[model samples]
Target: MVTSIILINAERTKINEVAEKLQEIAGISEVYSVSGKYDLVAIIRVKTNDDLADLVTNKMLAIDGIAKTETMLAFQAYSRHDLEAMFAVGM
Candidate 1:
């Protein structure tokens, strides 16, 4: 599976709304409200790059109040917990 970490910059007042919207997207596995340079983080897991692209471009970007996003494609799973989690994606 392809995994991506999408860091989001949302309009301050609309962060919660943006995060709620992100959680409704199909390929996204998790959405987190975080503190730092980025206000939210979305974890996307899909079977192919095309699926990842569709989720990011079509669904995620269309959400209101998402000011900006930076998507990072993960290359390898280093942590044991993450490796185990990868097997559970499609189940």
Candidate 2:
């Protein structure tokens, strides 16, 4: 599985609408309206890299009111429980 977090800069006054539209797109798992350099953040999960590319290029970029996007690809993840387990193993 491939995961991407897309930070979206939307047109003024269009954050909510843009976020709502993004939720309907395939591969988009979550969307949030945020206060920062970007207006919205979307979490996308796909089966392959090609699907991720298609989602960002065809679906997300095609949405109206979206000005720009920064995509971050996740490499590894460690939860609190995982960290505790790792530390305990060496004890």
RMSD of each: 2.8, 5.2
21-59 per-residue lDDT for model 1 (tens digits): 989888888999998999999999999999999998888
Give me the overall lDDT of model 2: 0.89
**7, model 2: CA deviation in Å?**
0.5
Error of 2 at 13 (Å): 2.0
**lDDT (CA) for every model shown?**
0.91, 0.89
* Model 2 lDDT tens row, 1-91: 8988999999998878899999999899889888879899998889999999999989987889999999999887556854896889995
What TM-score do all the candidates reach, one by one?
A: 0.87, 0.83
Number of the top-ranking candidate, with TM-score as the measure: 1
- The weakest ten consecutive residues by lDDT in model 2 span 76-85
In order, how many clashes per candidate?
0, 0
